[model samples]
Target: MAPNPGRLDVGAALSYGFDKFKANAGPWLGITAIVWAVGVAVFIFTFASTLTAAIAAADRGESAAVATTSGVFIVVTAFGTFVSYFVNAAFVRGALDETGGPEKPAFGRFFQLTNVPQIAVLALIWTVLTVVLSFIPFLGTLLTIVFGFLLSFSLTFLLDRNEQAVTAIKSSFDLTVKNFGPLVLLLLALAAINIVGGLLCGLGLLVTIPVSVVAINYAYRVLTGAPVSPAR
Candidate 1:
């Protein structure tokens, strides 16, 4: 498919995403379920004992033990979140195919787990750089937000555009600057949707998460001029 020359429309993209979610709820939810199940299992396996000890140490006013446990937790959580970026690419691709492609893509597309090493390495680079920049007080906050928005589409671009991880990161920042305002609106809207999902005892995520993926991929398609069918 050829890319479209027009820009993204935030509301229209989100509405299209919700529609796709309604149509493909089962498969999307299945993907979410599997991801969460594995995440929870890994968390338990890695941190269950440390977490218990941390809690006990906190009750005993043991600052050293608490700090150690907290630091370990942060590292583990960062690694998990890094891996999730790759997992999220699968969801983005599936959502793109569902909303705009002529035929359905495989439901387990996210689990294909290709390019994992590249994904992880890029993720680590971003994390370390961001963590350092995040320490600069007000300027740090501003830079983080700007880079956050700039790099937001990196994973989707990597998956959909067949770009290398570093190339995708660079492309995301470049394209995002061209359409900064609309993409920021889209990002805020997705964040709001996820906040609502979080409020619904976390079950709303089964719907909102995939919808967010669809919305971002839709923006990626429009901004990059990727060929896609009109959203129903």
Candidate 2:
């Protein structure tokens, strides 16, 4: 096994991510482009549709119309979130596969349809739980963050191990709680990377998104004492 298999090396994780991402920029960039396009399109469409409905309701002085518009907004948002996660599961798979590097990242590998059902269910569960709970007043925000942080590895677990959605979530929570301190630092570092990436006209996300996903997956393997293929 690689030396100190269970040791949390945030720097090493980040480094491996950069190396692999650089080596496989094509697929990563392609994946990012589609996801980015869909996200922007969805945001604009949702905003315009909901805003028009809201304004029309206001002009007509119809409280029922306003409520219906609000409900439509929530549903659209939830659906968008579900689609995002569903697409993101492929990235999770690509990132994790790139970890054990006997093979280079193949564009076709990212679209492997064998795992579709599991990832779809996983995304559905995550979207529903996160969106619904987040609408709560005080406890909502706290619980959402808590769940988000703890279940950060949920998708990774599902992809790497064929874990069911609920089991994956629970396992991720258990694992994260085990090495809380190191993961906290790793999580902060990931946030910083993405934040900086976001500042660059959001174009930086094309680079940062794959790197962060791979880095976090690397960290997961490390924390779980799983073997990582030697970094190329």
TM-scores of all candidate predictions against the true structure: 0.82, 0.91
lDDT tens per residue, model 1, 1-232:
6655587889998998897778767788889887788778768855885686587677657787778786766676666666666666667668667756786656766566556666776688777766677558899888888887888888776766667879989998898999989988998999999999989999998888888888888887778877766665
Q: Please give the distance, in angstroms, between residue 5's alpha carbon in candidate 2 and its true position after superposition.
A: 5.4
* Window of ten residues with lowest summed lDDT in model 1: 108-117
lDDT agreement with native, every candidate? 0.77, 0.84
Error of 2 at 192 (Å): 0.8
At residue 90, what lDDT does model 1 achieve?
68
lDDT of 1 at 176: 91
**Candidate 1: regions farther than 4 A off:** 1-4, 42-63, 130-143
lDDT by residue (1-232, candidate 2, tens digit) is 5545488888998898898888889999998898889889999989988887787777666886779688879888888888888677778878778886568778878877445677788788878887789679989988988888888898888877788878888889998998899899888998999999999999898998888888888888898877787667
Global lDDT of model 1: 0.77
Residue 67, candidate 2: C-alpha displacement in angstroms: 1.3
What's the CA error at residue 215 for candidate 2, in Å?
0.3
Clash pairs for candidate 2? none
